[model samples]
Target chain A: MMLWSVVLIPAIAGIAAMLPPMRAVRRSLLVATAVAHCGLVGWVCFATPVVSRDSWFAIDAPARIILAITSVLFLAAALYCVGYLRREEGRTTCDAEEGFLFHNEPEGIFVGCLLLFLASMSFVCICQHFGLLWVAVEATTLASAPLISFHRHHRSLEATWKYLLICSVGIAMALLGIFFLASAGRGHAPGLTLSGLVSSAAAMDPVWLKAAFILLLVGYGTKMGLAPMHTWLPDAHSEAPSVVSALLSGALLNCAFLGLLRGHTVLAAAGLGSFSGELLVLLGVFSMVLAAVFMIRQTDYKRMLAYSSIEHMGILAVGAGLGGVAATGAMLHAMNHSAVKGMLFLAAGNLLAVYRSKNTCDVQGVLEKLPVTGCLWFAGFLAITGSPPFGLFVSELTILKGALDGSHWVVAALYLAALGTAFVAMARIFLPMAYRLPDGSPHDGASSPGAREPVWSVLPPLALALAALVLGVYVPAPLWDAMRQAASALGVL
Target chain B: MEVVSDILVVLLLLSNLYLLAASRITACIQTVALQAVVLGVIALTSAAGGLTLVVVSVTLATMAVKGLVLPWLLRRAIRGADVAREVEPFVGFTTSVLVGAGLLVISVVVAEPLCSSAPADVSAMMIPTSLFTILTGLFIVVTRRKALNQALGYLVLENGVYVFGSSLAIEEPFLVELGILLDVFVAVFVMGIIIFQINREFDHIDTDKLSVLKD
Candidate 1:
C-alpha cells in the first residue's frame, strides 16, 4: 500500500491538475502533491522497506536511494516552478528561429505533465518487475516529451521530436531485451520479478542472459545519457525549460540507471558479474571522456550542464562497474549528483531568466547582477566538478579509491584525466559568467546591479546545495547502510 | 495450426519487405497495419492452449489499435502534412531491399542458438522472422528522412517485439502486456501529434532539416 501510494498519489494529482481552470490552484496542487510524495518516499526509504503482496512493487535499497533523490528533487523543482511560472505568466515570447510571437504551452498541461513525470519516475524506482519497469520508464519519456517542447518554438519542437523518437526507439530495444531475459529463464525461473530472477539465476541459460544484458545496457544506457547512445540528450536538455532539465538530469536519468543496475544485479546473481562489469566500465569511461571533450568551449551553458550530467552518469556507471566499495560510492554519487546537478540547473534557470540568453557570451557579470544566484551557481559549479567541501568530492574520492583498490590503473587514470578536463572546461565558462564583465558589454537585462532574487527560485537550490554540503562532511548512518546494502545487492561486495 | 502460424510469419516478413520498398507513405502505413492484423491472428494461434480470455482480448486489442486505429492516425497526420510519397529516402528503395535481404540472413544466423534452446512447440522460423522484422524496422528508421516514415519504422519495431514476445513460452501477467500495448499506442499517438506540430512549425516534416540545435 505504501509503495502503491507513492506511485499513485502524484498520478491522481496530475489528472486533477488538468481540470482546474485557474493557474494558482494547479500550482498549489503540484507543490502539495510533491510534498506529500516526498514524505511518503522518506518513510519508505528510512523505515522498513515495503514489498507489495505478490511482489510486483517493492522499495529495495537501491530503489530507496533513487526514490529519495527523486522525491527531494521534485519538491525543489515544484517550488521553483511556482515562481518560474508566475514570471512566465502573461508573457508572449518571440521565437528565435522563425520570429513569431507565441504563448507558452498551457499551464495546466505543463503542470499536469510535470506531476505525471514524477509519478512515472517514482514508478520506475518501485517496480520489481522488469516489464512493468519498462512500461514506467517509457511513461517517463512520453510524459516529459511535452515538457521538452513547452516553448512551442522550432528548436524545442525539434528537441521534443528527437527526444521522443530516440528514447522511444531506445526503450523499445529494452523491451526486446526483456523478451531475451524471459527466454533465458523460460520454464525455469518463475517470472520477471527481481527477487525471482536472482534466486533462480543459476538455472538460466547463459547465452540468452548475455544477450539480454547487452541489449539492456544499450537500451537503458541511451536513456541514462551514456555516450554513443547519448545523441539526443544535449539537444533535449538544453531545449527544455530549466526546471524540467533539472528533473531530467537529476531524476529521470537516474530512473534509467536504476533499470541498468537491476539488470547488473541479475547478471551478478548468475555469477556473470565480471562480464557485465567490464562492459559497464568501458561505456562509463567512454561517456566521461566524450563529455569532457564536448564540455570544452561549449557556447550554450545549458548544453554544458547537459554534458556535465552525462559525465556524472559516467562516473556512477564506472563506480558500479568497479564493485565493492566503489559500488557504494556509485550509489552515493547518484545522490550527490542529483542534488548538485538539480541545484545547478535551477541556478541556470535563474541566469536564463535574468540574462535572456543561454549563450555564455551573452550573459556577463552575474555576481554584479544577481548576487545570491551567482554565488549558488559558483558553488554548484565547484560541487559538480567534484571539488572539496561538497558531497561529490567525497563520492568521487570513494570511487577513485575503488578503482585503485581494484587495480584498474588505466580506468583510474582516464577517470582522473576526464574529471580534470571537465573541471577546467566548465571553469572557463562558469567563472566568466559569474565574475567577469566582458569588455564593452551591452546590458543584457534591464535589472540594475544587485537585483533582488526571488525567494522561491533562490531557496530551493540553496536548500539542495546545503544538503550536498552536509553529505560531503557527513553521511547519516541509515544512508550509509542503504548504500552498502544497495552495493551488495548488486553483488559488488 | 502449424501451417497457419507459418503463413502468418511469412506474411509478416513480406510486409516488412513491402514497407522497405514502398515509396508512398500511405502504402507503408497500410502494409504495417496489415502486418499488425496478421500478428493479431498469430497471437490467437500461438497461445499454448485454445483461445482463452487473455488471448482473445489481446488479439482484439492488437488488431483494433495497430490495424484500425494507428494507420488511421498516421493517415490523418500525412494528410495534415500534405505529403504523400517518400521523395528521396536516405537509402534508396533498391538498396533498402538489398539490406533487408541481408538482415534476413543475419537474423537466421543469430537466431540459431536461441532456437536450439527454445521449447519444441515454439516455431523455429518465429525467432528469426521477428529478428528480421526488428532489424528492418531499425533500418527504415535510420534510412528514412521523413519524420512520418520514422514513426512507421518505430511501429514496425514494436510489432517485431510483440511477435518475439508471443513466441516465448513464458506467461506474462495480463496487465503488463496490456501496459506494453497501451504504451506503444500512446507512443504512436504522441508521435503523430508531434509530426503535425513539426509540419506546422518547420513547414516540412523532413527530420534532416530539424538539426538546428546540434552541438
Candidate 2:
C-alpha cells in the first residue's frame, strides 16, 4: 500500500496541479506532494520491501536506496521550487515573443510536469519487470521534456529535441534488448520479470542473452550519459533551468543507471558477469576521459557541471563494474553525488539569478556579491571534485580501495588520473568566480543589487551540502548496511 | 500464411529501399506508412497458428498507430511547419541506397546463426528483414537534416523492432505490447510538438542549424 502511494501521490498531485487554481495553491500542492511522497518512501525504505504477487514491481534494497535519495532530492528541489517559481513569476510577463513560439508557458505546466517527473522516476525505481522498467524510464524522458523546455529559448528547445530524440532512440534500442531477452528466455522462463529471468538465467540461450546485454548497455548507457552516447547530456543539462538540471543530474541519470544495473544483474546470474563488467569499465573509462578533456577549457559553468555529472556517472560505472566493495561504493557514491550535485546546481541557480549569465568569464566576485551562495558554490565544487571532508571523497576513496583490492591496477590508475584532471579543471573555473574581483575597474566591493539570495533557496542546498559533509565524516550504520545490502542484491557479494 | 509472410517481408524490404532512395519528405513518410501497413499484415500472418484475438487486436493496434496515426501526425507536423518536401540528406541518394543494400547483406549474415537456433514456426527471413529495417532507420536518422526526417527514421526503426517482436511466439501479455505501441506513439507526438517549436524558433526545422551548444 505504501509502495503504491509512493508512486501514486505525485501522479495524483501532478494532475491536480494542472487544474485551474491559485498559483499559490498549485505551488503548495507541489510541496505537499513532495513531503508526502518522501514520507512514503521513508516508510517503504525502513520496512521489508513487499513485492507484488506477480513480482512485476517491488521495493528492493538497491531500489530503496535510490528511492530514498530521489525523494530527499525531490523534497529539497520542491522547497527550492516555491522560491524559484515565485522569483520567475516576477521576471517574465508575456507568453510569446517575436523570435520564439510559446516563449513563456504557464507556470502550472512546469509544476505539473515536475511532479509527473517524480512519479515516473518513482516508477523506474520500483518496477521489477523489464518491460515495465523500460516503460517507466521512457516515461521519465517524456515527463521531463517540458521541464527542459520551460525557458522556451531556442537553445532549450533544441536541447529538448535532442533529449527526446536521442533518448527515445536509445530507449527504443533498450526495448529491442528486452525483446532479445524475452526471446532468450522463451523456452526457459515464464516471463520477463527480473526474478523469473534470474532464476532461470542459467538455462537461457547465451547468444541472445549476450546480444540483449550489449543492446541494453548501449541503450541504457545513452540515457546514463556514457561517453560516446553522452552528446545529449551536456546540452540538455546546460540548457535546462537549474532545478531541472539538478533533477536531471541527481535523480534522472540514476534511474537510467539503475536500468543498466538491472541488465548487469541478469548477466551476472547468467554467468556472463565478466563480459558485462569489462564493457562497463571500458565505457566508464571512456566517459571519464571524455569529460576530463572537455572540462579543461569549459567556458560555461553549467556545462562544466554537466560534464562533471558525466564524470561522476563514469565513476559509478567503474565502481559497479569492479563489483564487491566497489559496488557498495558505487551505491554510496550515487547517494552522495546526488546530494552534493543537487546542492551545487541550486547554488548555481542562485548565481545565475544574480549574475544573469552562465559564462564563467561574465560572472565574477561571487564571494563579495552573494557571499552565502558563493561559499556554497565553492564548497560544492570541492565536494563534487572529491575533496576531503565530503561524502564523495569517502565514496571515491572506497572505490579506489576496492579497485586496488581487486588488483585492477590499471583501472585504479586511470581513475586517479581522471579525478585529478577533473579537480584541477573545476577549481580553475570555480575558484576565480568565488574569490576574484569582477572584471573591469570596480570602484570597490560594493555589493550588487539583488545579490542576496532568499533563505528558502539557501537552506535546502545548505542542508544537502551539510548532509554530504556529515556522510563523509561518518556514515550512519544503517545507511552503510543498506549500501551493502544493495550491493549484494546486484550479486556483488 | 507462409506466402503472406513472404510477400509482406519482400514489401517491407522494398519500402526500406524506397525510404532510402526517395528524396521527398512526403514520399518518405508514405513509404514508412506503407511499410507499417505491411508490418501489420506480417504481424497477422506470422502468428504460429491461426490468429487469436490477442494477435488480432495487436495487429490492429499496430496498423492504427504505425500505419495511420503516426503518418497522419507527421503529415500534420510537416504541413504546419511549412517546410520543404525535399529531404536534403547529408548522404547522397545513390550512396544511401548502396549503404542500405550493404546493411541488408550484413543483416542476413548476422542472422544466420540466429536462424539456426530459431524455432520452426519463426520465418526464415523475418530476423534479417527486421535487422535490415533497423539499420535503414538508423541510416536515415544519421543522414537526414530535417527534424521530421529524423522522426520518420525513428518510426522506421520502431517498425523493425515491431517486426522482430511480432515474429516471436511467446505468449507475452497483450497489454505490454500495446503499451510499447502507445509509448512509440507518444514519443512521435512529443517530437512533433518539439519540431513545431523548432520551426517557430528558427523559422526552419533543419537540425543542422541546431549547433548552438557544442563543447
Candidate 3:
C-alpha cells in the first residue's frame, strides 16, 4: 500500500498536470503528491517489510532511497517549474513560438511518462526476475526519450536521436549480456534470480559468467555514463529542460549503477569479483580524468555540470570497486551527490533565467547581480566541490580514507589529485563568475535591467540547499536505515 | 564442416569491411542487409538440433526484417531525400575500412582466448563478426552527412546489434527481437519527424548543415 503511494501520488498528479486547470494549482498538487510519496517511501524502506510481491516487483531499501530522493527533487523542481513556465510564457509571447512541447497536459503522456519512469525505476530496483529488470530498464529508455527532447527543438532532436541510438545499441548489447547470464543458468535451477544463482554459483560455468559480466558492465555502464561510453550524458542533460537535468543527474545514474551492481553481485558470488572490479576502477578513473579535462575548457555551464555529473558517477564506481569502507563512502556519496547536485542545477536554472544565456563568459557575478541566488549558487558550488560542512564533503573524504585504509595508496593519491583538479577547475568558473562582478551587469531584474529574484524560483533551491546542510550534519534515521538496507542488498558489507 | 560455416562467418566480417569502405549510402544499406542475411544463414546452420520449424521461421523472419523490409524502407527514404554519396566521411573510407579490419582481427584474437571453454558447435567467428558489425554501424553514424543517411547508418547499426543478440543464443530471443523492433520503429519514427522538421526549417535534411543548435 505504501509503495503504491510512492508511485501512485505522482502518477495521479502527473495526470492532473495534463488537465486544463490552474497551473499554480497543478504545481501545488504535484508538491502535495511528492511530499506524500516521500513519506510512503520512508515507510516502505524502513517500516514496511520490504515491498515484495512475488519475484516480479518489490521496493527494498535502496530502491526506496532512490525513489524518495527523486520524489523530493521532483517536487522541488515541480515548484520551480511553476515559476519557470510563467517566465517562459512571458518569453513565448516575444519569440516566434513553434508549438507547445506537448498537447494538453491533461493527456498526461509526458508527465505520465515521467511518473512511469519513476515507477519503472522502482521496479528495476526490486524486481527479482532478470528478464523483468531488463524490460524495466528498457522502459526507462523509452520514457526518457520525450523528456530528453522536451524543448522539442532541432538540437534537442539531435540529442534525442544520439541518445536513442547509443543507448539502444548499448541496451541491445545488454540483452546479449542477459543471454549470457541466462545461459550461465543452464543445468542449474534454470532461473536467473539472484538468490537462485548465488546458491548455485559453485556449479555455474566460469566461461559464461565472465562473458556475461563484461557485457553487463559495458551495457549498463553506458547507461551510467561511464567514460569512453559517456558521450550521451552531456547532450541529453544540457539539451533537456533544467528540471529534467535535476532528475537525470540526481536519479537516473543510480538506477543504471544498480544494474551494473546487480551483475557484479552475480560475478562476486561466482568468485570472479576482482576481474570486474578492476575494469570498473579503470573506467572510473578514466571517467574522472575525462571529466576534469573537459570541465576546464567547457564554456557551456550546463555541459560543465554534465561533466561534473560524470565525474561524481566515476567516483561512485571507483569507491564501489575499491570495496570495504570505500564502498560505504560510495553509497553515502550517492545520496549526498543527488541532493547537492539537484540544488545546484535548480539554482543554475534560476541563474540562466536571469542571464538569458548559458555561456559562462557571457554571464558573470551572480552574487552581486542577484544576492540571494548568487549566495545559493556559491554555496552549491562549495557543496559540490566537496568542501567541509556539506554531505558530499564528508562522503568523498571517507572514500579517500577508505582508499588509504585498504592500502590502495596509489589509488588514494590519484583520487585526491583528480578531486583537487576538478575543484580548481570548477572554482575557476564559479569563483569569479559567481563572486566577482563583471563590468555593466544587472544586479537584480529591477530598475537596472531585466532581472529580479522571482519568489517561486528562489525558494526551492534555498530550501533544498539548506536541507543539504541539515543532512550533512544529520541524516534522518529512516534515510540512514534505508541506505544501510540498500547497501546490504547490493551485496556490500 | 566447420570450413563452410567459417567461410560464411568470414563473409560476415568482409561485409563489415564493405560497409565501412563504401562511400555510397545505397551500398552501405545493401551491405548491412547482406550481412543480416548471412547472419540468418549462420543461425540456421549453427542450430545444434535439426532445424526446428521455429528456427526456420526465425531465420526467415530475420531475413525478412533485417535483409528485405528494413533496407527497402531505407532505400525509399534515401531516394526520397535524394542523397547519393556521403562525401565528407568523418574518417576517409579507406582508413575507416583499414581500422575496421584491424578491429576485426583484434576481436577474433581477443574473444578467441576468452571463450575457449565453449564447445565448437557454437560458431567461433560469431563474436568477431558481430563486433565488426557494431563498429561498422558506428562508422556509418559518424561519417554520413544527410539525416536520412545517418538514420540508415543507425538502422544498420541496430541490425548489427540484432546479429550480436542472435549469436548469443538468447532463449527468449523472440521477445527480445520484438523489443528490438519496437525500439527501432520508435527511433526511426522520431528521426522521421526530426527530418521533416529539418526539411521545414533548413530546406534540406543535411545534418552537417543542421549545425545551428550547437554551443
Candidate 4:
C-alpha cells in the first residue's frame, strides 16, 4: 500500500491539473501535484518494498527504483512547467485561428496531454505484466505526441509523425517477441508473466527464446534510441519544448531501458545472460562511436545535446553488458545521466530564450547578455561533457573502472578517449559562444529590451545541477543499497 | 479441412510477396484486406481446444479489426492523399520481390527446425507465412516514403504475428489483445492526422523534403 501511494499521489494530481478551468489554476495544480509527488518519492526512499499481487501486479525493489526516478523527474519537470507557462502566458496574445499550430498560445489540450504523458510513463514503470507494460509504453507515445507537436509547425508535425511511426513499428515487433516467447511456453497455462516464465525457463525452447530476445532488443531498442533505430530521437528532442525535451531525454528513455532490463532479466534467468550481454555491449559501443563522429560537426546546440544523450545511453547499455560491478555502475549512470541531462536541456532552453535560436553561430556575448542563463548553459556544457567533479564525470569513471575490472580493457580505453574528444568538441564551440562580447558595448546591453534574466527558467536546472553534483560525490546509504538490490535482481552484480 | 488450411498458408505467403512487390498503394491495401478475411476464416475454423475460448474470439476479432477495418481505413486515407501509386519507391519493386523470395527461402529453412517444437496441430506453413509477413512488413516500412504506408506496413506485420501465434494454440492475454488493437487504432489515426497536416503545410508528402530539420 505504501509503495503504491508513491506513484498514485502524483497520478491523482496530474489528472486534477487537467480538469481545472483557468490557466493559472491549472499551472498551480500541476506544481502542487509535482511537489506532492516528490514528497511521496521521499517517503518511498525510506519505505520498505511492498508487494501486492493476484498473479498480476508486483511492487519489488526494481519497480520501486523505476517509480522513484519517474516520480522525481516528472515532479521536477512539472515544477519547471509553472515557469514555462508563465513565460508562455506573457507571450501569447490570444487569437482563435492561429492557436493550435502557429500561436504561442497556452492550450488546454497541451496541458492535459502533458499530464497524461507523465501518468502514462509512471504507469509503465510500475506495471509488472508484459501486456500492461506494452500498453503503458505505447500510451506514453500517444499521450506525449501532442507535447512533441506543441508548436504545430510543419517540422514539428514531421517529428511527431516519425516518433510515432518508428516507435510503433518497434513496439509492434516487441509484441511478436512476446508472442514467440509465449509460444515457447507450450505446456504453461495461458500467457506471459515475469516470475512465472523465469521459474519455468529451463524447459522453454532455446531457439524461440533466442529469437524473442533479438526481437525484444530491436523492438525496444527503437525507444532506447540505439543506433540505426534512433533517427527519430534527435528530431523529436530538438523540435520539442526544452521542458518536454528534458522529460523525453531524462524520463522517457528510462521507461524503454526498463523494458530492455526486464528482457535481460528473463534471458539471465533462462541461463542465456551471456549472449544477451554481448549483444548489448556491441550495440552500446557502436552507438557511442556514431555519436562521437556526429557531435564534432553538429552545428545546432540542442541537437548536439541530443547526440550526447545517444552517447550516454550507449554507456549505460555497455555497463549493463559488462555485468558484475559494471551493472551497478550502469544503474548509477542511468540516474546520473537523466539528472544531469535534464539540467542541461532545461538550461539550454533558457539559453534559447536569450538567443532565440538553437544555432551556435548566431548568439554572441552570452555571459554578458544573459548572465544567469549564460552561466547555467556554460556550466551545463561542462557538466554533460563529463567534466570533473560533476556527477556524470563520477559515473562515467565508475563505469570505466567497472568495465576494466570486468576485463574489458578495450571498452574502458574507448570510453576515456571518446569522453576526451567530446569535451574538446563541446568546449570549442561553447566557450566562444559564451564569452564573445557583443559589438554594441556593455552599456546598451544592460538596457536591452525584454526580460534579460530568465530567472524562473534558470532555477530548475540550477537545482538539478546541484543535485547531480551532490549525488556524484555521495549517494546516501539507502539509495546505494536500493541500487545494489535492484542490480542483483537484474542478475549483474 | 487440412487442405483448406494449406491453401490459406499459400495465400498468406503470396500476400506477403504482393505487399513487397506492390508499387500501387491501392492494390497493396486490397491484398491486405483479402489476407485479413482469410485470417479471420482461419481463426474461426481452427479453435484448438486449449486454455480458453475467449482467446479464439479475440483472434477472430483481431482478424476483423486488423485485416478488415484497418485496410479499409488505409484505402480511404490514400484516396484522400491522392497518392495512389508509391512509384519510384526507395527500393524498386523488382528488387523487393527478389528479396521477398530470398526471405521466403530463408523462412522455410528456419521453420523446419522450429516445427519440431511447435504444437502437433500447428501447421508447418505457419512459420513461413509468419516469416514472410514479418519480412514484408519490414520491406514496406523501409522502402515506402509516406508515413501512412508505414502504418499499414506495421498492421500487416502484426497480422502476420496473429496468424503465427494461432498455430501454436497459445492463448494471448485478453488485455494485451485489446491494448494492441487500441494502440493500432491510435497509431494509424495519429499518422493520418500528421500526414494531412504535413500535406497542408508543405503541399507534398515526400518525407525526403523534411530533411531541412537536421542538426
Candidate 5:
C-alpha cells in the first residue's frame, strides 16, 4: 500500500492540477504534493521497504538511494517553482510586447506534467519487474515532453521533438533487448522479474544474454546521455526551463542509469560481469573524452552544464565498470552528482532569469548582479569538478583508488586527464561569468526590476550545495550502509 | 497455418521494399498500415498451439493500434501540417531500394545461427523478415526529411520488434503485451502532437530545419 501510494499520489494530484483552477492553487498543489511525496519516500527509504509477495514493486537498497535523491531534488525544485512561476507571470505581459522568449502557456500544464514526471520517475525507481521498469522509463520520456516545450517556441519545439524522437527510438531498442532477455530465459519460471532473472542467471543462454545486454546498454545509454547518442541532451537541457532542466539532469538521468545497473546485476549474477564492465568502461571513457572536447569552447552556460552532466555520467559508468570500491564510489557519486548538479541547474535558472540569456558573453559580474546565486554557482562548479571539501571529491577519489587497485592503469590515466580538461574548460567559462564587470546598463530589465534576489529561488540551491558539502566531510552512517548494500546488490561485494 | 504465416512474412518483406521506394508521404503511411494488417494476420495464424483468448485479444489490439489508429494519426498529422506529398529522401529511391534488398540478404545471413534454436514451425524467414523490417524503418527515419515520416519509420521499427517478439513461443501475460501496445500508441500520439507544434512554430515540418542547436 505504501508503494502504491508513493506512485499514485502524484498522478492523482497531477490530474487535479490540470482541471480548472487558479494558477496559484495549482502551483500550491505542486508544492504540497512534493512535500507529501518526499515524506513518504523518506519513510520508505528508512523503514524496511515492504516487499510484495510477487516482488513486482519492492524497495531495495539501490531503489532507496535513487528514490531519496529524486525526492530531495524534486522538493527543492518544487519550492523553487513557486518563485519561478511568479516571475514568469510578471514577465509574460512584458514578453508579449517585447517579443521575447517568455511565451507563457497555461501554468497548469507545466505543473501537471512535472508531477507526472515525478510519478513516472518514482515508478522507475521502485519497479521490480523488468517489463514494468521498461514501461516506467519509457513513460518518463512521455511525461517530460510537454515540460521541455513549455515555452512553445521554434527552438524548444525542435528540442522537444528531437528529445522525443531520439529517446523513443532508443527505448524501442530496449524493448527489443527485453524481448531477447525473455527469449534467453525461455525455460525459467517467474520470467522478467528481477529476482527470477538473478536467480536463474546462470541457466540462461549466453548468446541471447550478450545480445540483450548490448542492446539494453545502447537503449538506456541514450537516455543516460552517453556520447554519440547524447545529441539531444544539450539541446533539451539548454532549452528547458531551469527547474525542469534540474530534474532532467539530477533525477531523470539516474533513473536511466539504474536501468543499466539492473542489466549489470543479472550479468554479474551469471558470472558474465567482465564482458559488460569492459563495454561500460569503453563507453564511459568515450563519453568523457567527447564531453571534454565540447566543454572547452561552449558559450552557452546551460549547454556547458549539460556537457558536464555527460562527463559525470561517464565517471559513474567508469566507476561501475571498475567494480569493488569503484562501484561503491559510483553509488556515492550518483548521490553527490545529483545534489551538486541539481544546485547548479537551479542556480543557472536564476542566472537566466537575471540575464535573460544563456550565453556566457551576454551576462557578466554575476557576483555583483546577484550575490547568493553567484556564490552557489561558483560552489556548484567546484563541487561538480570534484574539488575538495565537496562530496564529489571524496567519491571521485574513491573511484580513482578503485581503478588503481584493480590495475586499470590506462582507464585511470584517461579518467584523470578528462577530469583535468573538463575542469579547465568549466573554469574558463565560469570565472568570467562570476567576476567580470557588466558592460551593459545596470538597470536593464534583464536584471530583476528591484535587484533583490528572492529567497525562494536562492535557498533551495544553497541547501543543496550545503548538503553536498556536508556529505563530503562526513557521510551519514545510513547513507554509507545504503551505498554498501547497493554496491553489493550489483555483485561488487 | 504455417503456409499462411510464410506468405504473410513474404508480404511484410515486400512492404519494406515498397516503403523504401515510395516517394509520397500518404503512400508511405498506407504501406505501413498495410504492413500492420499483415502483422495482425501473422499474429492470428501463428499462435503456438491454437487461438487462446489472450492471443485473440493481442491480435485485435495490434490490428486496432498499428493498423487503424496510428495510420489515422499520421494522416491527421499530414493534413494538419499541410505537408507536400514528396518524402524528400536524402538517398535516391532507387539506391534505398537496392540497399533494402542488400539488408534483406544480410538479415537472412545473420539469422542463420538462430534457426536451430527457433521452433520448427516458426518460418525460417521470420527472423530475417523482422530484422529487415527494423533496419528499413531505421533507414527511413534517417533518410526522410519530414517528422511524420520519421514517426512512420518508428512504427515500422516497432512492428519489426513485435514480429520478433511473437516468433518466440513464450506465453507472456496478456497485460504485458497490452501494455506494450499502449506504450507504442502513446509514443506515436506524442510524436504527432510535437509534429503539429513544429508545423505551427516553423511553418514547415522539415526536420532538416531543426539544426539550430549544435556543437
Candidate 6:
C-alpha cells in the first residue's frame, strides 16, 4: 500500500493539477503531493525493505537512497516553484536569442509536468524489472522536455530538441542493452528482475554481458551528464527555468545514475566487477577533467553549474568504481551533491530573476543587491567545490580516502587536481558575483530596480543549505546504514 | 516459416540501405513504416510457440504504432514544417550508403559469435539484421541535417530495438510491452510538435543552426 501510494499519489495529483484552472489549487497540490511523497520515502527508508510479491518492484538499499534524495529535492523544488510561478504569473519576456516575445507555457501544464516528473523518477527508483526501469527513465525525458522549453524561445526550444533526440537515442541504446541482457541469460530463464539477474548471473554468457553493460553505461551515461555524452546538459540546464534546472541537476541525474548502478550490480554479481569499475573510474576522471577545463574562464554561471554537475557525477562514478568505502562515499556524495546543487541552482535562479542575466560579467555586486541570495550562493559555491564544514567536503574526503585505500595513486592525483581546478575556476566567477563592487558605468537596463529577494525563494534553499551543513558535521546513523547497505548491495563491500 | 523469416530479415536490411540514400523526408518516413510493418510480421513468424494471443496482440500493437501511427505523425510534422527533403546532409548520400554497408559488415562480425549460441527456433540472421538496422538508424541520425530526418532516424533505431527484443523468447509482462510502445509513441508525438514550433520560430528545421547554446 505504501509503495503504491508513493508512485500513484504524484501521478494522480499530476492529472488533477491539469484539470483545475485555479492557480492556487494547482500550486498547493504540487506542494501537498511533494510533502506526502517525501514523508512516505522517509518512512520507507527507516522501515524494513519492501519488495513486491512477484519481485517486480522493491525498495532495496540503492532505491532507498535514490528515493530519499529525489523526494527531498523534489520537495524543495516544489516549494521554490510556488514562488517562481507567483512571480512569473502573467509575465511575458522577450527572448534574447531571437528577440521575440512569448508567453511561457500554461501554468497548469507546467505544474502537471512537474508532478509527472516526480512520479516517473519515483518509478525509476522502485522498479526492479529492467524493462520497467527503461520505461521509467524514458518517461523522465518525455516529462521534462516541455519543462526545459518553458520559455518557448528559440534557444530553449533548441535545447529541448537536442535533449529529446540525444536522450531518446541514448536510451534506445539502453533498450537494446536490455535485450542483450535477456539474450545473455536466455537458457537460465531467470527473468528480467534485478534479483533474478544477480542470483543467476554466473551462468550468463560473458560476451553478451559485457555488451549489455557497455550499452547501459553509454545509454544512461548520456542522461547522467557524464563526459563525451554530456553535451546536451549545459544547454538544457541553462535554458530552463531555475527551479526546473535545480530538479534536473539534483534529482534527474541521480535517477539516471540509479539506472547505471542497477546494471553495475548485475555485472558485479557476474564477477566482472573490475571491468565495469575501470570504465566507471575512467569516465569519472575524464568528466572531472573536462568540467574543470570548461569551468575556468566560463562566462555563463548557470552553464558553469551545469559543468559542475557533470564533475560531481564524475565523482560519483569514481566513488562507485572504487567500491568498498568509496561506494559508500559515492552514495553519500549523491545525497550531498543533490542537496547542495539544488540549493545552488535555486540561488542562481534568484540571481537570474534579480539581475536578469546569466552571464557572470553582466551581473555584479550581488551582496549589495540581494544579500541573502549572495551569501547562500557563495556558500553553495564553497559547498559544491568540496570546501570544509560542508557535506560535499565530507563525501569528497571519503571518496579520496577510498582511492588511497585501494592504492589507486594516479586516480587520486587526478581527482585532487580536478577538484582544485574546479574550485579555482568557480571561485573566480562566484567571488566577484557575490562581493565585487559593481562598476559605476551605466549600460542597457539589466538589473530591475524593484527586484528583491522573496521569502519563497530564500526559504527553500536556506533549508537545503542547513541540511548540507548538518550532514557535513555529523552523518546521521540511519543514513550511514543506508549508504553502507547500498554499497554492499552493489558488491563493493 | 523459416524462409518467410529469412525474407523478412532481408527486407529489413534492404530498408536500412534505402534509408541511407533516401533524400526525400516523406520517402524516408514511408520506408521506416515499411520496415516497421515487416518487423511486426517477423515477430509473428519468429515466435517459438507458433502464434498465441500474446504474440498476435504484441505484433498488432507494434504494427499499429510503428507502421501506422508514428509515420503518420512524422508526415504531419514534415507537412507542417514545409520540410520536403534532407538536402545537404552532413554526410552526402553516396558516402552514407557506403558507410551503411560498412556498418552492416560490422554488425555481422559483432553478431556472429552470439548467433551460434542463440536458440534454434529464432532466425539465424535475426541478431545481425537488428544490429545492422540499429547502426543504420544511428548513422542517419548523425548524418542528417533536418530535425524531422533525425526524428525519423530515432524511430528507425527504435524499430531495430523492437526487432531484437521480440526475437528474444523472454516473457516480458504485457503491461511493460504496452508501456514501451506508449513511450515511443509519445516521443515521436512530442518531437513532431517541437518540429512544428521550430519551423514557426526559426523559418527552417535545420538543427545545425541551433548552435546558440554551447560551451
Which of the two, 5 or 6, has more lDDT? 6
Q: Write the per-residue lDDT of candidate 3 for residues A1-493, one digit (tens) a residue.
A: 5545655565566666666664546556655666666666656666664433234356655566666676677667767776865665432222112333332112234455566566566656665656666766776776677777655456677777667666766776776677677778766735666666766766788878888888888888898999989998898888777877888888888888878877877777777777777777889888998898889878888888999999999998998787666776787888888888888888888877777677788778677678888898899899989997988887898788878887888787778888889999999888887866666655454544435888888898888888778878887776566566665655645
DockQ-sorted candidate list, best first: 1, 6, 5, 2, 4, 3
Model 3: CA > 4 A from native: A1-43, A47-54, A90-113, A152-154, A440-450, B1-80, B84-88, B91-128, B142-150, B173-181, B195-215
lDDT per residue for candidate 5 within B1-215, as digits (tens), equals: 57887898889999999999999999999999999999888777667758987789888988989988989987887675555568998899999999999999999998888666777777888888998998998898898898988999999999998888777665566767777888889899999988877887777889998998888
Task: Pull out the clashing pairs in model 6.
Answer: none
Docking tier of model 2: it is medium
lDDT of 5 by residue, A1-493 (tens): 8888898999999888888864558888999999999999988888975554457778988888999999999999999999998888743433321255546667888899999999999999988887888889999999999999888777788899999999989998998898888888877646788888988989888888888999999999999998879989999999899999999999999999999999988888888899989989899999999999999999999999999999999998998888889999999999999999999999999998877788899778887778898899888889999999999999999999999999999999999999999999999999999888766555443663335799999999999999999999999897888898888888855
lDDT tens digits, residue span B1-215, model 2: 56777777889899999999999999998889899889888777667557888789888988988888888988888675556578999999999999999999999999888777555665689889998999998889988999999999999999998888777654456767777777888889989888887887788999999998897
Best by DockQ: 1
Tens-place lDDT per residue, model 1, A257-375, is 99999999999989898999999999999999999999996999999999999999999999999999999999999999999999999999998887778899977788878889989
| Per-model TM-score on C-alpha atoms | 0.97, 0.97, 0.83, 0.91, 0.96, 0.97
Which residue runs does candidate 5 get wrong by more than 4 Å?
A22-24, A49-54, A90-102, A439-450
Tell me the docking grade of candidate 1: high
Residue B159 CA error for candidate 1 (Å)? 0.5
Chain A alone, TM-score for each of the models?
0.97, 0.96, 0.90, 0.92, 0.96, 0.96
Candidate 1: true contacts recovered, fraction: 0.83
Candidate models: Cα lDDT each: 0.90, 0.88, 0.71, 0.75, 0.88, 0.89
Best by lDDT: 1
Range of the 10 consecutive residues with the lowest summed lDDT in candidate 2 chain A? A93-102
Question: Residue B215 error for model 3, in Å?
Answer: 9.6
CA deviation > 4 Å runs, candidate 4:
A1-24, A41-45, A51-55, A89-106, A188-191, A439-451, B21-23, B46-53, B67-69, B72-80, B83-88
Model 2: per-residue lDDT, tens digit, A1-493? 7777888999989988888864669988999999999888888899976655458879988899889999999999999999998888743533221233344567888999999999999999999889888888889999999899988878888999999999999998998899999999987888899888998999998889999999999899999999999999999998888999999999999999999999999989999888888899889988998899899999999999999999999999999988999999999999999999999999989988877788898788887788889889989988999999999999999999989999999999999999999999999999999888865646466545536679888999999999999999999999999999888888756
- Which whole-number lDDT from 0 to 100 does residue A338 have in model 1? 97
